[model samples]
Target chain A: MSTPRPLTLIVNGEPRALQVEPRTTLLDALRERLDLTGTKKGCDHGQCGACTLHVDGERVLACLTLAQQAEGRRITTIEGLAGPDGTLHAVQKAFLAEDAFQCGYCTPGQIMSAVACIREGHAGSAAEIREFMAGNLCRCGAYPHIVAAVQRAARALEQETLA
Target chain B: MMDFSYARPADLAAAGAALAAGGMALGGGTGLLDLAKLGVARPVAVVDLTRLPGLDAIQVSETEARIGALVKMSRLAAHPAMRAALPAVGQALLASASPQIRNMATIGGNLLQRTRCAYFRDAAVGSCNRRNPGSGCAAVGGVTRGHALLGVSPHCIATHPGDLAVALVAFDAVVETWSPNGQRLLSVHDFFLLPGATPGQEFALAPGEIVTGLRIPLAPVARQARYVKLRDRASYEFAAASLAAGMSLGVDGRIADLRLALGGVATIPWRARSVEAALIGEHPTPAAIAAAAALAMREAEPQPDNRHKLALVPALIERTLTDMVGEPA
Candidate 1:
């Protein structure tokens, strides 16, 4: 059972092959095997939202997901949100402008979750944003700022789609 | 987490064989993986059940709703027609875990989820009977707030910690399972077992059997239903006490049928049969609803810390019924 098996993961639009033990979490695979450390490990378990990542376009807790379980799925981390030209995503830009974080520890997870919230049409208002993004815990008490950023980004993204 | 080998079974036979070889079935891996990391669960071989085909379909017919075991929690919660048909199912699902978890957790996994007792999760914590049988129940005396009052034994008092099972029990859902012998249908009420003396044996799934799907009869009571979850926070947390109610009233203002089930207050998703029996054929009032709800907790044995649930459960039922059906003048 301790033996490592090879598995290919399509992360950030590129397929990367790695060997991982069946017990190795997807969070560890991203940080240790691929050096995609943008995804922080808060609890290294599912308790904290620090390891939330997109699996096949849906946000999921990577810490609870086995690396082998994600073999056939497309995974997107915090690093994949920005463009190759280093252009920040709308949510990222809003996060920076609104100072949606204080210590910036939970920022990556917050931003990734905010992106999905808007994409899922759950960022319609302050209350909606708060309810939808409740999974990403911000211990810095930046919830008000986080809500404001989601609202700002949601409007901007809507305008971009309209434009 | 201990190292384990993984397998993807293409069909039921392969899954059965995998289970026969001492492999634990992995659904969304939310509960199992979390427990494995905590050293609560250690499976030498892991059988990934998500990749199995024909088990992800969500079919709603005129008379029934069949939800495959592999159907993600969010997938069913977001189904428009299903939501309109069986509202309690969606309500319970939405009231459950965070959006990120709902996206990954499967219905089958939710049904068989382990208790959320802190003693069960922490390896170095006080003695936990559920984690290691006969170790002694830590929740019995220490921090008994979240412990079960409805189905408590000296051995275990762990709450079921699931909302879907509560609503399924209310609407007469059937547990559909598959094994080498053939398909078997067990009522949701009988699927879950009480701790009694053996807290380790929780569910009624036979060895090497797999839960294929859940069959819910679209009873008339299901047409009008409500789920009220009272928790510390609004979302992303387990319920302190939750109620799922489905009621139908005749034109004469008398109750035609009523169904009730409670969560977060019982060891299993508890169907309040005595409560339902008291309300049937009678017009609902706040006082009558209050008294009827009391019948559900007749056998409750709450500790000093959790005695508040005695007042909370009846209030949830009374308020939900009053809001659903106006008092008969």
Candidate 2:
């Protein structure tokens, strides 16, 4: 048995405190402890990126990351992607506009990864988006839609910046 | 999963102390945590190496490029100077893992990552020499498709699954390490050990020693290198049979210098010295390149399932050689 340590994680611009064991992964902490179930756990060994989230503005897999290691970092998940008033983020809106999901189980992770992919400046073309977003696997074969959604979101974000 | 304690050490001394006390040093935790989940590694405690300073700098001089161990793979691959100067190293990093994993994984951790043998990963499997000493290798007759061809013993035939190390080995990079005893440097080629009777012992690191960085010489070959990864997929996949090759031509257009190393097809990052020797001092020709490239597999002992790699290695080497010569073969 391991002792539970106090961990204060900065999630979506807010500090959420919890007591977690040393072996508790960030995926489990977000879903089971913090009630942030939007970040789904697909393969908990970092092979699948269904639990993709942002730590300090960079995307990383939550399943392989220990919750204790996320201290003092700005963590963002799928639930926090939209505006506080419930307006969907540009990526989220583009995902809907492109129908980038079939079963919808992988939507949140796809959206989260797509957001980071564009921000990382890897969404310049369809091939680049496909290669960068290859981490997030979707069993429903939504890659074409996902690429379109990323392209749409990239254009939207670029226009917003220009505006 | 086993229960273990985690510690955030302030400096290298504290981190070494914890490691000396039967704790594993966690860098990115990408490899260690995954193996721990499978019960492959059972550490009693882990000390995080992220908070330590000065180990994350990328220093480039006129003579060499020094990459700190704690630098993330994504940051290094995306670095402008590294891509411009060491494109093979950058391509290797970009081709190794997914974006999310590259974002979290460190360069040191990437070099020290374990082999992706199925028998070794599953602790439930009994016959794995790398995982359990005195146990036999189940991968030899079980599933030999991904098994190594070059550095194989009766005990183990696991492939060293790393991309960056292969390119570094081709470029004569030096691995720098620190220990409670002292600081030391070793050739990256010698850092990886051949799996013999004791297949469990992997690297040449001393007890409680940690890799600090790697220093790569800025040679003509290093400047004009490329990493060709033949994998099952285009992205987020390990190499099936990859080649890291570099060549420099003389004023007469002959091969002045050449270096070759293989990944995903050998037990260690294999430097194709025989191939390099045969190609040097010869004019780039179809027949000459073919004969030299075939020497890469002179000593390969392939099994039933992996005999395809026997055909793949020489062809990949020839293709890379042709690419270096700026011709179609």
Candidate 3:
């Protein structure tokens, strides 16, 4: 094995520095090294979006991203969504209100993706939401509720922006 | 994944030098990283191309649209200029994999994505000719519902799992690349090699050659182009059979020009020139479209489980053409 290299990323608005192997994926760096395990690793491959997170405000599959690629970039995992005072973000609150999860394994990634979807203005309709959120797979079959939660969260985010 | 050295080169010359030494060019890493994880690809070094400047520009003019190879699929699909110039390109990209994937997958990476054959993906399966040359193809006799039907060789029948290449081929796009020999341009048709005896040799690009950009010449009928993809699910899944069709109508309601290409039915993105030839000056009636569609797949050779593609290919072609001409679906 090669020597670990020092890498730095502005993760969740904090400058995080860590030593990582060249092959360490962003998903592993977040979950294993940083102890932010909210991003799940379903399928490990890019086929499943269980490791979805935001890189510079765009939703990307963390498992497919090498840690070195995230260098000097802002990465927002599900752990970073809520306020520092433990106040759930609007999307999290909407997901809770809408009951958008069952087993909840895929919820973190789904919620992360949903927040980005709303921010990107792709949550205009339920069908559009489903099309955009197709990356995150929920085996528990909470798609209908998940769509509802995204709609509710989009509205809340809009109101928050207005207020 | 294997332990390999990674180098992020900010210049094309550095990336080219690394690639010339047998290091793999890493773009987005959506597909290559997964293959590395599966042990299908074992590179000694990875040349990261993300930091290279001017490789992600999308310039659209009156005559042609030049898209950087590193442009993300999501960005290209949502670009208003591309939508106005070439709707098929956007449609093909949007009809592809899911959103998060689209955000990370590069245009060059999409064109060079590996086959999604079950046998090829599972390196442990031990019988994919593409994965291990001369090992024999497991999909030939095993489960092959998704195998190629048009350009299948006895050695391999894995379908090319890309929608963008199909649309590019239909529009006659040109691929620009930089290699050890400097810069060059290749037509999309000549870019993807047919999987014959050497199923592993999928691209016409030389070792260490990095695709830099793609140029799609604009046509009068480009905005009328349509990409129709039929998959198992409405989203995220690979195409079962897809069609990228475009046409321009003359004043007399005749076909002025036409372009057609098929996906998920061939070893490469299959250009339907036969269908295009049959419809080029003919009035695009239902019978004429059916005849042209029939000509499109007349040379199809389907295996045991994939005979449905023979019918599906022509049906998709006819439907796509009909829809392109503003006929009722």
Candidate 4:
């Protein structure tokens, strides 16, 4: 057997070094190794976005990314999206207000993606948000509420900036 | 999962060199990693290209656009230049996979991604020609609702699963590849070959070759281009049938030039040269477009479950052309 490779990843703004197999996905490293269970794994394949997270401020499928590839990159999970005082991100608040989930298995990934969607300027219109969020499948069929949450979050973020 | 050694190269040349050392190249790891986890692509080594530099830019010039291999599909679609120069390509990218997959999936990976054939995905299923050549295509007589209707061979009938590649073929884009020998450029049409006889060989990339960038030529016709995809669902599903149509009309509503390519109906991106040849210098009327659309699908030989695709092709082409013609001046 070959020796395990050492990789250093910045998860949730914290630097973590670990020895991992070459085949370990970022999702596996996060959930199994680092104990960040917020990023859920639905389809290990790219078809589902339950393992969504932010790699350097952009939403990426953690399940498809190799842990070694994320070395030195800033990774933001759902647990890290809150402020220093643990105040909810505007998107998180909107999701709660709109009840954008049912079983909530996909909510973490959805919320992570929703925050990124707004930050990336994809919350312009409901259609745009729907298009951008198409990757995160809600098996519970909560699409309308999810879209509404994104729209509300966009408005809230805009108002906060004005205030 | 099978054990494999992995190496992350700092640049394209190093990545190519690692690939030359008898390892499979990894990009985005969406497709390849999944296959590896399922013990499908059991290579001895893996060359990681995620950290490779200079392969992540979307450069737009006045006359052309160069998209790096590592450029993510979401970024490519959202890029202002791509939206302006080749809206059809952007639309196709936007229509592919989902936003999360799009963000992680690179343009090169999207082109090189394997088919979504159920038999191919499940190695224990009836032998798949694409996974193992000459093993016989289960799709030929098996469930083939999604099989190819054109440019297929007895060996394989797997339809290419890329929407963006189909549109690229319609735009006559060139694929720029780098190898140990030197750099070579190939038209997208030639880059992806028909599954004739050799179904195992998909892309035309040689051993140790890396697709560095895609060079899209400057064409005014692109302004009037459209990519229309019909799928089982409105989003996040493979194309049931798709049309990428590029047309340039003269001032008097006559067709100066026309380029049409079909997806989800062929082993490769089916460039409708037959349709283009018939429509040039002809009047840009619905009747002429219909005639050309019919000509485009004339040679379509659909299998038992895929015959509906033949009917869907004409309507998709007509609608795509109509939309392109109706866009704002």
**Which candidate has the top score in lDDT?**
2
lDDT of 1 by residue, A63-154 (tens): 98999989989999999999999999999999999999999988999988888899988998888888888888888899999999999999
* Pick by TM-score: 2 or 4, better one: 2
How would you encode candidate 4's per-residue C-alpha lDDT over B1-329 as one tens digit per residue?
A: 57778898776678778888798988888889888776667878889876677888999887899999999988899899888888889989988987777878889888898887777888676587778877888787889998888888888888899999988998889998988888899999889977888878899998789988899986988877778899998788899998888788888778887878888988888898988898888887789878878876788888999888777888888777767677733
Give lDDT tens digits, candidate 1, residues B243-315.
Answer: 8999999988788999999999999999989999999999787778888987878889998789999988988
Model 3 segments more than 4 A misplaced: B327-329
Q: For model 3, how does the per-residue alpha-carbon lDDT over B182-239 read when each residue is reduced to its tens digit?
A: 8999998899888789988998888778999999999887777888999999999899
**Model 4 TM-score relative to the real fold:** 0.96
Backbone steric clashes in candidate 4, count: 0
Candidate 4 wrong stretches, greater than 4 Å: none
Q: Each prediction's TM-score against the native?
A: 0.98, 0.99, 0.98, 0.96
The chain B TM-scores of all candidates, as shown, are: 0.97, 0.98, 0.97, 0.96
Chain A in model 4: its TM-score?
A: 0.96
Q: Clash pairs of candidate 2?
A: none
Interface RMSD of each: 1.2, 0.6, 0.7, 1.4
TM-score winner among the candidates? 2
lDDT of 2: 0.91
Flag regions of model 2 displaced more than 4 Å: B327-329
Cα shift from native, residue B247, model 2 (Å): 0.2
Cα RMSD (angstroms) for every candidate in the order listed: 1.7, 1.3, 1.4, 1.5
TM-score (C-alpha, index-matched) for candidate 3: 0.98
For model 3 the local lDDT of residue B201 reads 93
Q: Which 10-residue span in candidate 2 chain B carries the lowest summed lDDT?
A: B320-329
